[model samples]
Target: MSAATTTEQTLARYYHLHARLYDATRWSFLFGRSDLQARIAALRSPQRILEIGCGTGRNLARLAHCFPAAQLIGLDLSADMLARARTHLRQHRSRVILRQQIYSQPLAPAPGFDLIVLSYCLSMINPGWEQVIRSARQDLMADGLMAVVDFHDTRWPAFRRWMAVNHVRMEGQLLPELQTHFQPLDSAVRRAYGGAWRYLRFIGTPRPIVHR
Candidate 1:
């Protein structure tokens, strides 16, 4: 199996064991989720929103509240996570759609979405994260927005190693790649836990495709 495949399986297992604890435990450290949503809402009134790796539907629930008329899709690879998301987002069933799948390519046959979100998911994707970013560009409308809130990097080597064991890469890598494929409208990195680590929140529009 490829490295990406192994990583995907590993993450599925990890979330399977942790899905129930995710929402409760993650809030303490998974900073900037609400802030990211606010930043995106400030910039656009998206009618169709797609959130990749929407664990436990926390952000999906927020998106539903933020955009009352928006049709929302929350995609995750973990069945356990989706199960929790389904229940958590039950109230918004009319507007929210949940799917279980790895996102390495564009959604077929459907028109692009007005907004795409990745909340704390890109870092766990290991070898395929860059491809996911590129695929998101394809999944977006010409003037669509992409919003992300994720771990940026850490100052402590020990903390980095611990996060690696948990399948997260915190090396300040995502922003540069995001900038390459999208035009930044708003982006910032904030310190967490007194600067032991940092996380980023970004809102951007897809860069115009360049014809060769």
Candidate 2:
């Protein structure tokens, strides 16, 4: 299947059907979201924020708490997910915009967004996940920050091996794809504050090529 088609199918199968159960299961498999949140709180430029693959708006809700003054945009490919997000966000409807669309490309160029966050959303993409990260790097403003927290294979042999096999059997997923996707991006892997989960956070700002 083409990238677009696969994107559509993945959204429907995983996000649409799974969105209602997302936050319930989130703390189980998605362990490092708070690490992403801390990085988000530190951003100073482009005060507006965008969250790509914002499943069920859980992160958006927390982000609103952290940055109440920032305008929020949440986009997801799953209509069902958006439905739940919409309902949850009604109280803050004026402060939020939810779009049912894929983030395979850069969003309509907006000015001065302080931050764009992707929280545990990269593992599901079959391909072009790297491209999405790259596109986000380009779309950022000079001082804009991009914060991402996703699955990572810690350099431990036994636990790494166990998580790899366990995830596929349990959730039909694995982190190697995302590990490979982010390998070339300017980023680092830090141990999460909680006990077991390690976080992969990358920050990018537009760097102009200097003429010698």
The candidate that achieves the highest lDDT relative to the unseen native structure? 1
> lDDT scores for all predictions?
0.93, 0.66
Give one digit per residue, the lDDT tens place, for model 1 in 124-206: 99999999998999889988999999999999999999999999999999999999999999999999989999999888889
TM-score of each: 0.97, 0.75
lDDT of 2: 0.66
What is the Å distance of residue 35 in model 1 from its true position? 0.5
lDDT of 2 at 14: 58
Query: Model 2 off-target regions past 4 Å?
Result: 109-112, 154-198, 209-212
**Candidate 2 lDDT tens digits, 1-212:** 78758656855775656677777876866766776677556655345888988878888888877777878999888888888888778777889999988777777564346577888766555455666765665566657776777765454566566754432121222333334323323466656545354656665555542347
Candidate 1 Cα misplacement greater than 4 A, ranges:
109-111
